[model samples]
Target: MGMDVYVGPLTRYTLGDWLTVVQQTMQAAGREVRIVHAEPEPEDVITDPVAVSDAVRSWQAGLLSALGSPEGWTDEAELPYWTDKPDWDGYGGMILLAAYDEQPEFRPGTRRGLLRRESRADSARAFQDAPAYKRASSNPTKYPTLLSGVEWWLPVEVAPTVFEAPRVTGQPARMGRVDQLVVELTLLAKRLGLDDDQLGQLRQAGPPDSSTDVEAAGRFGLAVFLELAHAAQLANQPLLLDY
Candidate 1:
């Protein structure tokens, strides 16, 4: 399966009217608020939106605090909107990471091989041969920045981790900074020789002809990510990577 990106309130579609009511309450309060509820049953169809909102806010607050609460933080009442759906899977993500890993500029303690050019097949093989935990991005926490963590409602700022609480059921959960991710993604796009026009074309382009075209798939995935990251940054909303 592929990944779907989103930026806005968490689970706004699924909770429906319940989410609306809770969002209204949050807006009216004009300050941080929390709602408590009993644990839900396994077969429970309708979840308590208040509890969900509370969990989301609690997670956001803790993450923001950890992030030092960068500028442009806000509590806006906006519905969740689909950003982009990349035609790639976890392995595809690994492929992108592998490509970045091959770049000498991105590597640590070395500046050699800056002019080297490798094929997409080489990147695919690199991913296949490399260990699971590869230093593809400049994340201090060693997490795969864009494809794994969640970007909160704040301006772009880098951090090791954002959220401390358990993951929200189906919402964007892992904490991340949109700005730093943009920097990393932009670097990757440049390394692949993908310009703005090329990125836009790749964003609309279909998946690669062969899954073996790992570099093409990686470029397509990067295009989708850059679009969504920019949107999330501009809107000051959370960027969800729904797998």
Candidate 2:
């Protein structure tokens, strides 16, 4: 299967909000939401438009919660981005949180914050350890253009991804600062195999696009990754990857 990778924090909306979105989306597709009621002796397949809508909505809500709610912790199965076979979870062994609507802040007590913190420490340490030390970009000014599509986020208490659908065709969705950082990290981790010294050079060098050396290009991304990690921790957001 082809993989689509997304890096960002969860959205902060309610379960009802997502249910509404599901209904609207279904309606727009000219399909009515439906479910079967299997109680009270006779098992019946529900198709009354309003009843079907309500039944499907209620069912979806249950599914959302059973999976994961931003309001509470979910088993790995409930986590939106989690799969038995994850393509990547190498962010310093931290349990990455995918979006849920209820909780707006990063969950406490995880090593997810280590990457940025380490990057920051490395930045300061490098210069002190060596006068001419190059450092990764601590605070990058811009982000490379992300792919054009509906970006997703976890609404506050919802388990489903909220699509940030573009208003105009071919127009790109804007990513949050932390989201940008997550993407940067994902790319660097996947593409670069630099040592600490190379990373230090990347820190001092500019963004990847400007670099001619192949490794430096990768390092540019690593620099962005470090900055994003710092930003994620500062904002109390999780660095999540969706593949």
Candidate 3:
């Protein structure tokens, strides 16, 4: 029942933190990995699926182009940070792979090997192929985190996500399951000073993938959603209203 998974509200956490946890999890598992934002785009919060896809594609392209060519594809001295340029607001996090997980290598000009091979094309093409890029993260949960207290194992399923067959290696990570996560989150709420509603709000918003199959969605949905909500709460800090 345990299906290992990466957690996040892509916007909620820093790129470093997000990537760290993700790398750790996948490294423990010794498998190819992927992370999809609960909210692929800010607009995904609305019911506009079309707009969401378009936005995600744009971001996807810009990201690859930048990573593939850190000093600017066309040889510009300064390159745009992944945050603002290309309006990083679209999509959750990125679809990353742990190419050589042993030590989280920093190969020159090689950042995201996890992205679907096709998404690596020019930014425009990545956007146009939104559906495919979106699917890249749709993988059956192999290792999900334990929520806190649940006793039984719940298979981790992240549907409409990108996946690759896991290559079990040294110190392989145990899989994360939904049932176990339910228990963990119950405890997480108390530890983090979050009530059920806070957790519920987090749980409610999940990755935008209506086209995914039923099985994966049902399993890993809540775990992934909680991560997003947590991140969103951090990234979108509420403003005080002056009376």
Decide which is better by TM-score, 2 or 3: 2
Ten-residue region with minimum lDDT total, candidate 3: 81-90
lDDT of each residue in 21-118, candidate 2, tens digit only: 23456889998764221222223434344554444345435544554544422112122321111111121111111110011132222134454212
Model 2 TM-score, 2 decimals: 0.26
Model 3, residue 216: what's the lDDT? 24
- All-Cα superposition RMSD per candidate: 10.1, 18.6, 22.5
**Which candidate achieves the best TM-score against the true structure?**
1
Higher-lDDT candidate of 2 and 3:
2
| TM-scores, one per candidate | 0.62, 0.26, 0.20
- Candidate 2 — what's its lDDT? 0.31
- What is candidate 1's lDDT per residue for 1-243, written digit by digit as tens? 334565665545335322222335577887543433333334654467666566656655766565665543453335545455564442365344543454434432333457543322234424433222244333423334543434342344645544433444543345556676677677767766779999899777655654445556677777777887787777766665543
Instruction: Indicate the residue-level lDDT of 122 in model 3.
Output: 18
Local accuracy by lDDT, each model: 0.53, 0.31, 0.28
Residues 8-78, candidate 3: write the lDDT tens digits: 22122212232333445678898755544432433324234344344433543454353342321121112
Where in model 3 is the C-alpha error above 4 Å? 1-174, 202-243
